[model samples]
Target: MVDVGDDAPTFSAPMTTPSGDIEEFSLADATDDGPVVLAFFPGAFTSVCASEMTTFRDRLDDLTDAGASLYGVSVDSPFALEEFATQNNLNFPLVSDIAKEVIDAYDVSMDFDALGVEGVAKRAVFVVDADGTVTYEWVSDDPGIEPDYEDVEAAVGDA
Candidate 1:
């Protein structure tokens, strides 16, 4: 597995937005020559992810002040994400991962119920530096746990 301190894998890929619109975005887009905090979740409309993302949204200003841009990723359809964002009022880009390509590349997928659940992304966080190096990555099973914002802020500021 690629862990913290490992170089980040930067790529430009297609991810639908909350409007069910297909768009290609680069991790570079969010970085803005600074740091980026990429949060990956299994799907949308879940309590855990909702809470996590809402928290991120609420504190986006602080994250930006720390020179970090926040992004959320999930395997839900763009249509689903649109409804989810409408319901939850998420401001940041809620990226679609219907194909699971990026999720698999990040090594955060799992298999279950004889399904392609392995293709769905697992909950995780990755902080990349200005040069696209992964400075920190946290992959965990407990989706209920909120991310360590203090750590994220420090990393972004120091990066």
Candidate 2:
């Protein structure tokens, strides 16, 4: 997993925003002057994923006030992400990692053999500084559990 102090791997990928517009998003571009929070969930429209994203959406101000932007990532397609964003009323970008490259680079891929789903991203969060360094990272084996928002906020604030 990419840890704190490590250089963040930058990528340009397609994302669906709250307005249902599909656009290309780049990590380096997002961190021009502040920190960014990348929230990787297993799949779109799942219960835990929905709840986590909704919490992030509801606390958008806290993140913005901390000089940070949040992006929700999953292996879902752009169409699904658009629908998900619309359904959740998310004001941030719901990124499409359909290629699984981002999740692999961050080492958050999961194996769900029993459910027959593989290469799904684990529940994870990454805070990256403007200089492209990873300031904080959290990965969970259990997808149902959400990351500590307070810790994430503090990390972004410190970054």
After best superposition, candidate 2 residue 16: deviation in angstroms?
0.6
Model 1 C-alpha lDDT per residue in residues 1-159, reported as the tens digit of each score: 667777776666556564556677688765665888888987788788888888887878887887777778888876677788778877777777777777877888865546545566677888898878888888876656767867777777777
lDDT of 2 by residue, 30-88 (tens): 99968999999999888999999999998889999988999999999989999999988
Shift in Å, residue 142, candidate 2: 0.8
TM-score against truth, every candidate: 0.85, 0.98
Clashing residue pairs found in predicted model 2:
none
What do the candidate models score in CA lDDT, each in turn? 0.76, 0.93
Which candidate should be chosen as best, given TM-score against the real structure?
Answer: 2
lDDT of 1 at 10: 66
lDDT accuracy of residue 103 in candidate 2: 96
Q: Where's the lowest-lDDT run of ten residues in candidate 1?
A: 110-119
